[model samples]
Target: MIDALPPLREVIETHGLSAKKSLGQNFILDLNLTSRIARIPGDLSGADVLEVGPGPGGLTRGLLAEGARRVVAIEKDPRCLPALAEIAAHYPGRLEVHEGDALEFDPRLLNGPVHIVANLPYNVGTELLVRWLTPKVWPPFWSGLTLMFQREVADRITAQPGGKAYGRLAVLAQWKAEARVALTLPPEAFTPPPKVHSAVVHLTPRPEPQFPADPKMMNRVVAMAFGQRRKMLRASMKAMTPGIEDVLVEAGIKPTERAEQVPIEGFAALSRALTARGL
Candidate 1:
């Protein structure tokens, strides 16, 4: 067991802190859980880590305690800085807490090899993952993402075809990264416990997507197709294509296929066709 960091409950009480709903805070004080998450992305030693919404720094402490070479924590809510600062002091420079919004901050701008680990603020978790997956450049800025999301969202992120959860998120995430469910934490594990149970998902970016497609067009195609997921591709993509059957033919997808039935490559092909037609 790691022993460097103090008990997270003590840290929270000392800061007179409670999770703030406005900030989408759900502080996980369970060292066991946090440590388990910290370990999900493999060896942390000598790796730079980007942590977001580190309210009360439980996961931050776990990352550092488990020997991450450096941690840059971006906490959106200013109220949590003092609590995080205490952990920074405890670790003596291994931790760097940035009091700002992680969404606006570009992880690519950070110095070196980075892995992202966060018990993410629920409101922005899916958006954040999309941003990372479809960054302006391919082969994203982070080495891996070990993040906590509502169990349902986690299911969608790592879901397979033929499942209700499979749709745009599964296509996008799996197209660019290898994703899997790492662990699940009950509601009671957090300070101001969230109504939903949380699951940790680990995603490693793939060197190449299953198929080549323009990122912007890919996003648009997925958005449009899944925008009316129940409809067949021929109907759903009709707005952009009077000849979606032909487009599907050109891409080797079937006109009758639904968005959930098509895998990542199918979306990539559609994305490429739309880009080719300048849709």
Candidate 2:
């Protein structure tokens, strides 16, 4: 056991904390598994960690036990507060729990070097990741991210060009950070197992984007191209500007290439060409 406190199963039974499907809650009761997830971000000894949807504080305890300097956990569910409070008391000034939507919580309030590690609520995982990847500032507050997502989403984040899984997510993630699937967990690992398996993705933000392009414009370009993945770039992106083929040629991209066939650098170049033409 990593802690002197009662086992997670006992805590849940005592608190009557059954997993709620509405909140995308799937509690991991095993400390060993939670601890292993915590260790994936490497040494947390000197960093403050940000966690979201910490249902019953399973990963919270793992972080503390693994020696995270401080953990700021944002939990939307009110039922988990008392259980998390128990952990805060156990750790004595190491764990902080906030009862609210993680979407509203601001990590900038916390002192850096912050590393975000969470068993993210499945409903909001992709949205949260997009927010983190596209912060207003070039380098976001968090130094790294270790997040759990459905296996398909994981594949998208780590995918390369010319694959079915590659699309806007791959472009966005790879443009901003170095991302990889660090761990995969079976469905049975949770208290109320989900239908699909989950994987943990680790991302380290780059000092700058892989290539320079207006952020908003790049996103718009990517969105338009992938909005019809089967269509060639010329057909799919014609709505982007009057001279789409000229723009594609200037970017060194073939107009006949589909969105899935265009690499991140290719998209970046397209974004730049559009910007140059004042699109």
Q: Candidate 1, residues 1-279: lDDT per residue as tens digits?
A: 356656777777877777788788888878877887898998978689999988888788788888998899998877788878878888887888888888898676566688999989999999999889887677777889999999999999999987799988998899899999999888998878788898999999999887798877888888988899999989998987787789887888999989888888788887888778867
Against the true structure, candidate 2 has what lDDT?
A: 0.94
| Clash pairs, model 1 backbone | none
Query: What TM-score does each of the candidates earn?
Result: 0.94, 0.99
After the best TM-score superposition of candidate 1, give how far the Cα of residue 14 lies from its true spot, in angstroms.
2.2
Backbone clash count, each prediction separately: 0, 0
In candidate 1, which residue ranges exceed 4 Å CA deviation?
Answer: none
Model 2 ranges off by over 4 Å: none
